[model samples]
Target: MKQLSLNDIQAAAARLRGKAVVTPLLSNIELNRRAEAEIYIKPENLQHIGAFKFRGAYNRLSQFSEQQRQAGAVAFSSGNHAQGVALAAKMLGMPATIVMPKDAPAVKVAGTKSLGAEIRFYDRWQESREEIAQDISEQTGKVVVPAYDDLDIMAGQGTCGLECVEQLQEMGMTAEVFLCPVGGGGLIAGLSTAVKALVPSVKVLGVEPDLFDDHLHSKKAGSRQKIEGTPESICDALLAPMPGKLTWSVNSRTVDEFLSVTDAEVEEAVRFAFRYLKLVVEPGGAVALAALLSG
Candidate 1:
């Protein structure tokens, strides 16, 4: 896998310009007061696909060659990435096939299909989506647009962190710390790289659900760790068994620390965002705020 560099991030920002939404950097007085520190929320919940996944997905698909674009695209995602790829491919006039777990949220599945992507459901307990995706690729001759492991996707995801730093500069404020939820580790890896590159003094922290803290364990062990059993957490988006090899490589070097939060804390944070911020944040999306609150 190729390393996502600063130049790649810059190119991603340019490629995604006018294609992806530049989500607002919001500061809640209540959260700042409660955390006893300056807090800024990059409201990715308001993004086109309702999450930051769109940044990476769009960036990756937008760079596809004419032959690849004509051949279509395939990806395996539980939720957000499915919607992101579906929407991006639709916008670019390319066909997309998404393989999702049968137990994935109905809202996400419906949203992805609404964008005209072909949906295939697999049993997470019995089948490997990676193998299924590869089979689909072989059968359909579609290019596999991986969710996190690809260099283009990582560069695209880094655009979020780039926007965060730019927003801080515009506000005449700088963050001492940056926190993001970790799953397959793409978002955190991309964000940490961008944050540390732009604001070298800022601390980049990855927040993981206690039941699915593979990134935390992997970092400590100096290798990727896979969870054998089912994840018991309500943060469905953070339940990846282990970080992607490419994402882990970037994160192992860029991220400053890791923090784990309980399922109940994630639930409360999601509820709080919905009630107070009027944002329908998924449990995984609210993990960063959960960490700040718990601390």
Candidate 2:
């Protein structure tokens, strides 16, 4: 059982200094009016690789020894994490191989390839991406960088929460709630850990795609639960099959509740971000906001 402390998150913040992008906490009066609450959004879309995954990817890979760096790294993701690992490896001057679903968005595939990572496509419906990554690791002797299941990765993701808390304090305000998007639960797990430690009273909420509500089910069951079948949804990044074991350990304790958003709601949220917030966001990136706006 690996327990994460605020110190771990702080240490990650220290490591990410001058490395990770410090995305802003943006709010719109229109959004506040609709949600009936002063909602602040941390838009990781501005982060490198166009997602928050880069923070964890770089945090985990940067700690590799000289020998490990030389040997290279491997990882599996639908899209965002693949791009994150590829870009991080490129920045660190290490070779990378990414196992990605065949149906992963084309733009993300091109982004990963542009970073010079070797891409292996798998059938998400028929093949196990974890097994593929393990086989690649065994054969190539590359370090397997799991997207969300590692301690360093979670700690790295926690930096997002750390920044949010600090930014709020700087604004002379305290948040009453935090809504985070969840796939395999890395972001929310680390985020909840930081928020719970810094502001104990804030309600930490996890939002998932309605078609893929594994987190909601897992919370109700008091254990990790897997979604069956490949349900179609516009939120491709949120199609993760199950909650990560280590991520669940932290999420079960720190997360206060879980919410699910529909594809239509996510589309609306994306439009809102562009029209009002003046930011471009993907469907998965907007689900947490979607939950709030839909209410």
Instruction: Encode model 1's per-residue lDDT on 1-295: one tens digit a residue.
Output: 5777888898999999998899988878788788898788998988898888998999988988999899889999999999999999999999999999999999999999999999999998899999999999999889898888888898888998999999899989877899999999888888888888888899999999998899889889998999888767888888898889999989999988899999889888988788777888989899999998888
Whole-model lDDT per candidate = 0.90, 0.92
Q: Write the per-residue lDDT of candidate 2 for residues 1-295, one digit (tens) a residue.
A: 6598889889888888888899999888999899887888998999998999999998899999999999899999988999999988999999999999998999999999999999999999999888999999999989999989998999999999999999999999999999999998999988999988999999999999998999899999999899897689999888887999999999998998999999999999999999998899999999998999898
Off by over 4 Å in 1: none
Could you say which candidate leads in TM-score?
2
- Score residue 124 of candidate 2 by CA lDDT: 91
Q: What lDDT, from 0 to 1, does candidate 1 have?
A: 0.90
Clashing pairs in 2: none
Clashes of 2: 0
Kindly state the number of residue pairs that clash in model 1: 0
